[model samples]
Target chain A: MTTLMNRQYYLASRPAGAPDSSNVPARDVPVPEPADGEVVLKNLYISLDPAIRGWMGDDPNYIEPIALGDAVRSSVIGRVVKSDSPDFAEGDVAMTVGAWEAYTRVPGVMLNKLDEAAGIPLSTYLGVLGPTGLTAYFGLLDVGRPKAGDTVLVSAAAGAVGSVVGQIAKMQGCRVVGMAGTDDKCRWLEEDLGFDAVINYKQCGDYEAAIRVACPKGVDVYFDNVGGEIFDAALLCLNKFARVAVCGWISTYNVPDAPGPTNLWQLVAESVTVQGFTVIDYMDRFPEGIAQLAEWVVAGKLQFREEIVDGLDNILPTFLRLFDGSNQGKLVIRIPEE
Target chain B: MTTLMNRQYYLASRPAGAPDSSNVPARDVPVPEPADGEVVLKNLYISLDPAIRGWMGDDPNYIEPIALGDAVRSSVIGRVVKSDSPDFAEGDVAMTVGAWEAYTRVPGVMLNKLDEAAGIPLSTYLGVLGPTGLTAYFGLLDVGRPKAGDTVLVSAAAGAVGSVVGQIAKMQGCRVVGMAGTDDKCRWLEEDLGFDAVINYKQCGDYEAAIRVACPKGVDVYFDNVGGEIFDAALLCLNKFARVAVCGWISTYNVPDAPGPTNLWQLVAESVTVQGFTVIDYMDRFPEGIAQLAEWVVAGKLQFREEIVDGLDNILPTFLRLFDGSNQGKLVIRIPEE
Candidate 1:
């Protein structure tokens, strides 16, 4: 028996700077067949993250850049249509990269078979239980090295990575301060996530003053996802021997030129250490992170939130939400069944 | 019968910016008597380093500031006049932090007894076997860590510290390049000190081009003493995982407002590590450094140079040479007997 496939999204042209709807052209292509050691997956949910901006360019990074006119790269939860590999069979759910399309072929070694009958939602695998959660886990523990009673400051605190980072810091017995673009997100962090303090950066004209109030003792460990004025403000208020893990510079990726921080001299005065890292550096211990995140979710010690939009057509607009700070939590695209 | 005491110089007033002869008022002070565990020494030769600027300012540092109306602070080598302590007698030569004057009363604990009769000149103890040598030793070993055949670059190479640093890198089996302000200094470094290559930055309109010619394999370790445009150029040509040991920033110390580098993003791109350190941080390993340096000198593996200016009255002018690159090698002031 044959099955019909929906339209797939392929890369049309490489972007010079910020990517828009026109930069990524969508087209229909034949569904791929599962050869030996391969499985054909019908993508159900795709994860859109800020890291995609780096993949769009031909820069050197941990992951390979997707070539122009190739299918846009993403992580997706999908159901197997056919499996030529021994590890998977037809109708088995799998998690793999390149979930931006309706159907993708993944190798058996790379696919993680999931039990769809389980009570947990599918989008959770793309978020708190997947790459984002693992990033927050290793970045906070190995890089930042937060301790009990230490002050932890996280930028973009209400977003996917930041929200999880605050809760983990709180769980580790730290005084957490979350900086978000809106009052509602800040309020949610304080009220729902048990954060010690929250600052709506949009309302405050002086970010350093806001940080002074939010973090009275000064920041010990800073997980920097957004790198712009907030980064400079945080850098100014860092305590002696502070550790800054630069996971992503989402703030500068869109701009043609990157701006300089005027207060970089503060690093010398405080003996601060700043490091830029990608999640691939911690891939060896990814399972430990996923298991711990799962245990936290089941024990009610951690909460996961998602803003799911219907249809594959909405992926571009949903991805743009990351730059505008519109989404409260992890953003996902739920593809309709063909 | 009491003999006439030697004359000394006192701080007349703090300068707004660059120090001058008017800033130090020459005066005749009564030679101080040695108390218990103390030795009164007749100042023979004293090192006039750039660090004196830090002592003259009211800013906090590792050591105490020089107060107005008090004798200026410096590192000096002298002969003991009378010792109340068991460590030394009337004729023992010693090195202590007492430059700036004809006679200095130093605690015995702070004095390192020197043997002027040893085959080497007493002035060498103030250059290659003193704090300058220690700075170069630790800055290279602990910070730069140059590997065999690696390209090592030293700024202000003909100066006391840079000369030893480049020689040490050569001894470690690395390709050494020295950057000096004058053609004569560059010739001296290449001919006398065994540097693989030398660049006279004053003559070279394009330093990066000179660096490319001198260092065909690119710079792996950059020992930076002169900071400003020289530092900015080095940062651009640093290899991946390069180490920059910032021993001093002499270029910016005299300027009222120092301009920051525009190419700092290169640091992030190349994953370069820049560390600032002081000689005091390696007090425990001073003996090891001095021993190795002395052995190198005795074996003809290392050479020492001193630029001596006679009379304590010339201290201000001699000291000013460091800022203008007028003095070659270590600048020392030789005081006359009373």
Candidate 2:
């Protein structure tokens, strides 16, 4: 058998602000054989998340920063090419926290075997049916805790996590208002995703006014994905005892000197609850989340979209699209068939 | 019966910044007669709290703003001079949400009869055994949720709510760090309040460094009463899954253009929970809080202090002392004996 080479991206240096080619560069290395209790995965899809920008920063955060010369950390959907553990077999599709690479050698313990018979695309696992779905599930339902007739406002509403958040809030009998970057995205959120109202934030000059018009009764639960100005506007419109789930702050992820919400005192004035969470914290309950999310999808209550990039070569540019608000839904790269 | 005149302070105009004589002015009117189900309360001890500043503002808040020409809202301990309801009788001491006045016509339903034989000062009911104590109890225990090994940091540590918060956190077997304005206050917190560490924020120019030295293990629970810089500093020292009880923002109460915390994203990075609450929201649990606090006070496990200003004539100046950090503990104006 001929030796195969694996192309991967590594953290060359910590970026000052937004990452570019200079900070994260690609390198080629020979694919390694699966050792005992490990599996050799042929990566098919790599998730490009706004969270990647946070992991690239040198500051202390929810998880350890990616060390210099290390393969950039990411979540990937891959097929096992070789397995030396009882948990996984060759040709099995699995999901794991892997690297931005064409092939990865992962510990069998880290892998969650995918059900190819589930009839959903494997990429959905990385979007609505995987961690992204779990984030929207637990953050909105558990953290936000919306009641029927409650007004739920979501930012970055057309994106993967926000889209799922709006749908789940709707399923819970809430009046959902979403804010997205483009008119097209807002239309999709309203006309297609069943959002009660949508605000194209890029065109809406006064977000507070737009929010007031959309949510006349005031927002009872704010599912914030894009922080900063939008967050401040939402704070002004919060009803008494409102809940704000501090999901990803995608807008400020790249800006090192991002300003915080000035209206945070509203949290006190309105008796609001603002909680920040990561999906990893709920790892023990993953089975429950996955099962529930699957049921929602199967019942036609939850819908999702994927903006799939064609190749690993376009990873850096595709990742940048997350910050620019260019990519809709869950941004992922489909690797070249080997 | 001889006619009695009532002396009161009214909200003349909404202050552009900090309130002064022009905004909150004094007036004299005839003492109101008790209507059906009402009692005429001769205000004796008036409680001065930082929350009063929020009420003076024209903007919407937890409670309705003090409308112009309305008696400035306050919590008062008084003796019922006249009663038209069976719930109250002449000469009975009670606590009620009244006004900055010599006499208030209050609904008997709103008055809580105080036990004169409880062996605690009637004014203590305005402090440790009243709304102040209840605020600390519920805000710390219910919102902060400190574990035994947690590092609890409290701002305005020598003041009413903060002082009680520190003592109770200590009772819960947590290490407590306090931040106060003056060295004397810090000393009082460390020497008397059982705080493990204290930072005199006035002298500690670099609050973040001081917090690092005080709470080496990182803050697990932050009971923030004084917002602005001290609050921002505490945010930087938060441990994973930290809980922040946003009790008040005294520092910004006087400053109309207060800067918001820039490091708020740390809430997301650390998976923190920040909740804002008022004692009013937990009215249903007041009996539990009052009982527990009374037990602690009786068992000598809890201690409190009151800065009493003699005479109703000192009410305005006494209220001003709250924002200036001139009062070491709970500030109360003692009405001269009638």
Candidate 3:
């Protein structure tokens, strides 16, 4: 039998601004057989998230920065082609912390077995019923802690986590306002996702004024995904005793030496709590988050959009769509099974 | 009583940097007669806190900005010279939100009647056992939430609030590190207050390096009283899930358009919580905090310093000492009872 080959994009060097081919280079190598308790999988779905951009830089260690020469770290679903442990079998589908590659070799203990016959789309696990859903579930409810009638403002509102956050806030009886980069995304948020108000930040001349118009009651909870001038504006719009749940600063991840929010003193002005967290912070409650999210998706209470870009060759450009706000909803790279 | 002439410092104009005579002009105006529920106090001890500087500016409304033509807002302990309410009688000593004036006329309900016969210096109510102590008590315990063995680092560690915060952390069974401007203050924190380690921030080459040297375990709780480059450095030294209890940013209060802490991205990196609050946030629980603090003071477990400057004329200069870090501990203006 011919040897299986893996096409992978590995971190060649840390990028100063937006990444290029020089920083992340691609190559083909022989797929290694599973060793000890390891399982080798042919990747089918690769989640493209702003967090992946964060892992590429070494500036902030929210999670451990992806080491040089390693395949860029990501959440991936794959079909197990080889296994050295009883936990996984050949052809069994599983999800794990993998990489930007055609094949992934992971420890059996790290893999979460997925059921393909359950009728739930496999890609949903990478989006609404997985880490993306869990991030919104915990970050909003746990950090934001919105009460009924409280105004919840979400930045990067069209993105996977922010969308889920706004939906969850609405269910919590909050007046949900969203800020997205494009008019299309704004319409999607207001018309489709049930956001009380949506600000097309691209057209909004002054962020503070736009936020004020959108949130008359002022923002009690601000789920911040994009941190920069927008984050600075949100600081000014916060209500007394407001809470800023910082999920990630996606806007500043690619830029070198991004300026910190200038209006942090508003914290004292309003007695605010600005907390930073990641989905991994709730590792032990993964099962609970997945079950609750699945229930919502099945009962038709939750609505989400998944933009799937096919082929491993389109992975890099597909991922870049996240930074420019071009892609809709949860972005995923699909490599169809041969 | 000879028609009382109240000599008070009123805000003439908003100051650009430090308030000179023009910004805060003194005028002798006729004292207003007691209203139906009003009690007039012959001001004895005026509390000069860093928070007073924030009230002088028209920006960041933590409390209502001291309106133009209004005397600079402060906390003062005084003798009730006149009373129109049954709750207060003439010669009763009380503490209330007064001003930089010889006498204050306030509603009887706003006054916290002090027991001068309890053998405690009435000025101590303005420092160790009043808002200053309660600030440290709630800010360190409620916000910082140190879990015995946690490393607590305090900036402006010799000031009224910081000094008390370090002592409170010690009682909670934590390794306490302090950062102060002078060797004397550092020595006081180490030798007198039982701080495990101390850093003279002015002499220290880099704030981050000094903090690392002083706190080898990394800072679990950073009680920040001064914010600026020192705060940027402190962000770099925070451990995972660290809590930053921001009492006030005295450093930037005077500097116009002071750049914010540059390394705020560390919040996401460490899952940190940065909360800003005032003692007023705990107004409902003030009695509880004051009682607990008084217990610690009575047992000799808590130590504080108060620098009392004589005469109301020295109020502006004495208050400015806070910005320069010159005055040690709680700085107060004392006008001897006539």
Candidate 4:
């Protein structure tokens, strides 16, 4: 066989703020051979999530920060090219912790084998039926704890996790309200996703007023994705015993000095519980979550959008679309099979 | 009988910052007659708490803000001097939502009759066995949810609620660390209350460094009373899945523009739960809490301090002492009965 090569995007240095190409530079190296109980795969799809930005900084998180000179961590789906363990075979498709690279070599035990005959797109495993979907399901049902007749307010309501959260909350018999960055996104939430109300946050001059108008009963459960001024206003509009499920704060991820919520005192005023979590917090229950999410999708109850960028070269720029609110839904880079 | 007069400290105007004499001034008016369901009480002990300061502002709270031109709201143990309801008779002692006045007229149904004959100090009803103690009990046990071997950290450790929280957390088999303002207070928490470690925040040059040294195991539960720079620093030292029980942010109460805790991002970093509550939140279980606290005090297992100022006129100044950390433990005002 001719020499095989792998192109990877490796972290050159920790980012001070929003990462630049200099911080994550392209590197070309020969893909390593699979060790015992390891499998080598040609990665098919690379997931781009806002959480990736958080991992780039050397801050204490649910997981360790990506170390310097290592490939930036991500979740990817791929087809196995070589295997050294009976758990996997050549040509078997699977998914595992991966990076912005053409190939990945991982322990066979780490890979969750995917059925190519199942007729479901592999990219769906990286979006609505995967981490983002699990995040919304667990965060909303367990943390947000929306009761029937409760008003559920979700920020970034058009994005991957938030969209799934709003849909599941509606299924729980809640009055779901969404806040998205654009009128089009808001329209999608209201006209298509069956949201009770939608606030185009980009046009909503005063967050508190818009929230009050949209949720006249006051927010009983706030699914927080974008933290900052929006979060501050949501604090003021919380009902007594409100629950704030914080999954991410994409708005503040790039601003190192973002001011803290001025109205946090409302937590005491309303006897609120604000819990922060990552999907990994519910790792043991991901199987249950994925199965339930898949059922919802099959029943036509769950809808999602995935933006597929065609090449690894566009990964960094495509990932930045999450912060700018330019991406319509879950974003992924597909590396066409050679 | 000569017309009875009530000496009330009324809210003359809202304060811009720390309440002064002008914000709360004395007034002598004839005590009003009891309505059909009301009983007039000769106020004996008025509870002074930091929550009263929060009520002074027009901010939304567990209860309505003390109405402008009304006597400042508080809990008072008083003797029934006049009755229009059969539930209470003249000279019977009870506690109800009273104000900073020599006499309070309240609905008889709202009065919790005190068994002063039990030999416990009547003032104890407003301190250790009352709101402050109950706040510590439920906030720590329910919200903090400390597990055995957990490291529990408390701010304002010498204060009424914090002192109780640390003791209860110890009872639950957790290691307790306290932060106080003075060396004497720190010694009281350490030598007297059996705290595992004490940090005199006034002398500790760096809050995070002191906390790390004191809580070598990392903080699993943080009972926060004073919020400001101290709370921000404490957030940085939380362990994974830590719980922060926020009862009161006394440090920020008087500072209208007190910058919010900047390191709140740690909530996500450690999957923390920051829950805010008042003793009122546990209204249904107050009796259980009081009984447990009383048992602990009777068994000499629970200890508390109360600085009872001699007169109602001194209530404002004594309440301000809570902010300065000058008044030790639970603070109350005694209106010596005739």
Candidate 5:
């Protein structure tokens, strides 16, 4: 029997600040055969998320840290190359939490079958139609609970999760204002994504004032993906009984010593609720989120952008693009076809 | 009819940082007669709260800022000396949002009649059975939602609201850890209030380490009355899905430019919920809170302490005691009894 050599990125060392090549190193290893209820998958697409920075550190977080000398953790959409379980068969496309590798041997229970005939690209499952969509859907609807006519403000508006959040808020009759890093991203959000207003944080001198002008009635719901200065500005614009759904603090993920918002007391003055959540917390309700998001996509109401980086060897540099605000949308790595 | 002279404190100027005699001045004016639906009340007790500091500033808060040269707002227990309203006659003890004055003519609709014969002191109406109690009750039960065996950590645990919060969390079958400024206050919390652990933050070398030692299991519910370094420390000790009921940030009330918590991103890592609320938001459910608190007080299940300052002339210095942490328990001014 011939064995497959898998190309993978391993955690070399815990990062001091932003992760670099020294922290995550690439290597080639023989892919192990699946035993009993496990399956071997050939990863076609790997999700490059800001959260990967968090997994590089030893700090306690939503997910466990990737041990040194072990394969870096990631989410991937892959095709089953070999199966030893009744739940999965060869040639089946599956989405699962796996390592940053060309091929992964995972338990069958961990895999979710993906429909290849749905017409949507398999890469979309790693983005808007998958965990990202589910996060935006549940975080905004359940935690934020933006009512119609409410002013909804979202940070990192051009990003994968945040774009969906703004659109969903608009669908709920909310006046959506988004904050993006660059003028191009802001233009994309306002002109292409149907955002009512877009603030370029890079250009805005007074973020609070800019937010105030965009959200004339004050922010009723703030979907925060970037924490720090943006979070502080959003807190100042909170209306009475505002809700802040803290999905991710991508801006602070790399800077381990980043300062918190100075305007948190506004939560008390405005009777605000700031709740933090991850998509896995709503795992049991993924079907509901996927169904709703798929309907929106089918109806041409929800739009998504993917910035795909090719080859497994480029994984380390591709993941670094998240912190630099260079990635235009859902940043994904396309693993070379075996 | 001869008009009575009224002694009141009015806002002279907005304070830059902490309020003083220059910002809040005492004035003598004629006590006005009641109109058709108004009642003349002789203020017997004036509640000195940390919230008064916020009112001294021109910035917006839960309630309106006290206008310059206007009477400073406060919650007071007073005797209805005269009434033109159909609801009450003279000698009825009432609780109402009024001004820092010897006498006030308020609309009868704004006053909540207190049962003087219920055997609870009228001053207790300003503390444990009043807004302070209601703030703790609803803030903890409704917002914090602490379950049995949960570790509840409260800052300013020797203060009026914090003390009550600790007691209530204990009554609900949770482990409670309290942080207070003075060792005496810490002793009071553990010995008198049944707190599982008490940390003297002023004496503790490392606030987070002390908190971790006190709450080994981790903080499930954090009732934050104080914000600043203590708040930052508590954020570091939060457990997964912890709820933080931000009833007040008294520590930052006097400092206009106080720094926010540096570890707030722990909310995302731990999936925490931090909500801010005022007691007035729960006005509709005040009766329920009062009933429950009154029962606890009567059954000896709840205990409270009062640091009463006599005479209206001492109002400014007495109010200042709140920021300096000199006043113990519910600080109240015993207005000279006629």
Candidate 6:
């Protein structure tokens, strides 16, 4: 058996603002041969997300920047093509941070075996049963600390993590309000996902006014995915002792100059808490998070949707759909069905 | 006795860029007699704090502002000159929240009996073993959650609250750093209050550099009293999971417009928690907090200083001391001991 397989590598040129295909060029390269405890995986699905925008920058962050001449670092759902250790078999499905290409090798330590026979789709491993799932679970429970009957307001409502967060809040008996970019997403969130209320931030010229109408009792917990003006609007409507979990500032990611709220005095008046967190922080509790999220999805208490594009070449444009607020749900790049 | 009292009102003719005696006025009238469930007290000491500046303004706040015609509202340590309440006696010492007056008729519900035989000075009730002490207790332990070996940084080191905060952090086995307005205050914080390091913001000129020097391993908890530049400096040096208890922003309080930081992006990278709170929010646990603070002081584990000024007329000037950062520790007006 040959140890080598082809992988994708991004080349020189970092974007000044929003990234385009011009900035991320995939190149074919010799696959890394597995070490003593490594596995070679055939890429199946790649998680395209707003956080990936941060990785394109050279600035220091909680997570390391994706090097200019390396495969775009992403969470990938793949099948084991070969294993250098006894832990994994050739046909085993696994989830690991891997390349954009067809085949790659990753350390056994970083890979989690995925049970494809468990009735969850392979794309779910890149979303609802994977990193995004863990992010929503830990971020809401640990950071937001939503109480029963608390009013929870989530931004980017129909997005992968936001949808999960609102559903989880509802499961906790909270009154959930969602802010989405479109009326279609709002309708989906309200009718399909069991959200108590939905606000189309794009149609609502005054974000704060929309929040006021949506949350008449004031927001007790805010799970913020899109920051900037949305965050500003949410802050003004916070109840005393409100909890704000800042997961990602997707709105600010593409803007060359991110303009935050000028009225931060609201934070002081309400005795609120604003916390920023990375999904990686709760890695130790991933299994427990995934198990509970999977149970909720299977029980129909939580509903998730994936907007998957069928080809690898469409990955860049599909990724851009998130920034433009055009993607209706979890945007997964479906590798051409082998 | 006539139903009137001699008190001072610090009327805000215009919001002061820096508070001065010109913005305040003194008035006199007959002392009011007590009503049922109320005590007529002669104020022993009135607390002069930076928070009084906020109360002087017409802006909406946690507590109501002092109207131009009304007496100034501040915390006071008083002796019951006369009483109609079963809980208080004529000679008993008590703490109340209506100060800047020679005499006051206070409700029983708002007064706490002070143990005159406890041997601690009466003015100490206005500071340590009082609201300031409780603020430090709950803000650091309850909100900040400092663990053993953590590095704690406190701004306004020699002030009533920060001094106790540094001492309590030391008791928790944290390496405590204190930032103060003067070199003398910084020296006192290190030599007398058991802080591991002290930096005088005035001398350092570069607050960020000073914080780096004082907190070598990075700050795990920041009890922010003087916000503006000190908070900006601490934000830069916070470690992952750092907690900032925003008890007050004294540095920004007097300014017409509070200048926010430019480097708030650091919050995302460090995953810091910034929470604002007041002692009133923890009123249910006040007894526990006060009891613990008193025990620490009695055991000589906590030490404090009071800068006392004589007469009710001196209340405005003594409070002005807080804004100028002239008062070394707790500023108290003696209220013309008669």
> What's the candidate order when arranged by decreasing lDDT?
4, 3, 2, 5, 6, 1
Task: Order the candidate numbers by DockQ, best to worst.
Answer: 4, 5, 3, 2, 6, 1
Worst 10 residues of 4 chain A by lDDT: A1-10
Model 6 pairs in collision: B4-B30
TM-score of 6: 0.93
Give model 5's docking category.
medium
Q: Comparing only chain A of model 5 with the true chain A, what is the TM-score?
A: 0.97
Compute the DockQ of candidate 4: 0.83
What tens-digit string does per-residue lDDT give for candidate 1 at A248-317? 7777667756665655544444546565556676778888898999999999988867999998988887
Q: Residue-wise lDDT of candidate 6 within B1-338, one digit each (tens)?
A: 54655665546364567656566766676776778788988888888877777777765466777777666788888888888899888888888888577887888778988888978788888788788888888999988899999999998888999898999999999999998878889889888887899888888878888899888999999999987777877888989888999888888777876655545556677788989888888999988998899888889999998898887766666677887789978888886654
What digit string (tens of lDDT, one per residue) describes model 4 on residues A1-338? Answer: 44459899999998878898999999999987888899988999999999999999988888889999999899999999988879999899999999889999999999999999999999999999999999999999999999999999999999999999999999999999999999889889999999999999988899999999999999999999998999999999999999999998999999998888889999899999999998889999998999999999999999998899999999989989999999999999999986
TM-score of chain B of each: 0.95, 0.98, 0.98, 0.98, 0.98, 0.94
User: TM-score for each prediction?
Assistant: 0.79, 0.96, 0.99, 0.99, 0.96, 0.93
Name the regions of candidate 5 deviating beyond 4 angstroms: B82-88
Model number with the top lDDT = 4
lDDT score for residue B118 of model 6: 72
Cα misplacement distance, residue B137 of candidate 3 (Å): 0.4
Chain A alone, TM-score for each of the models? Answer: 0.96, 0.97, 0.98, 0.99, 0.97, 0.95
Residue-by-residue lDDT tens digits, candidate 2, B1-338:
65679899999998877788888888899986888899998998999999988998867788999888998999998998999989898999999999999998988999899888866789998899999999999999999999999999999899999999999999999999998899889988999878999998888889999999999999999999988988888889999999999999988888888877888888789999999999989999999999999999999989898998988877887888888888979999989775
Docking class of 2: medium
Error of 1 at B237 (Å): 4.8
Candidate 2 Cα outliers beyond 4 Å, as residue runs: A82-90, B117-119
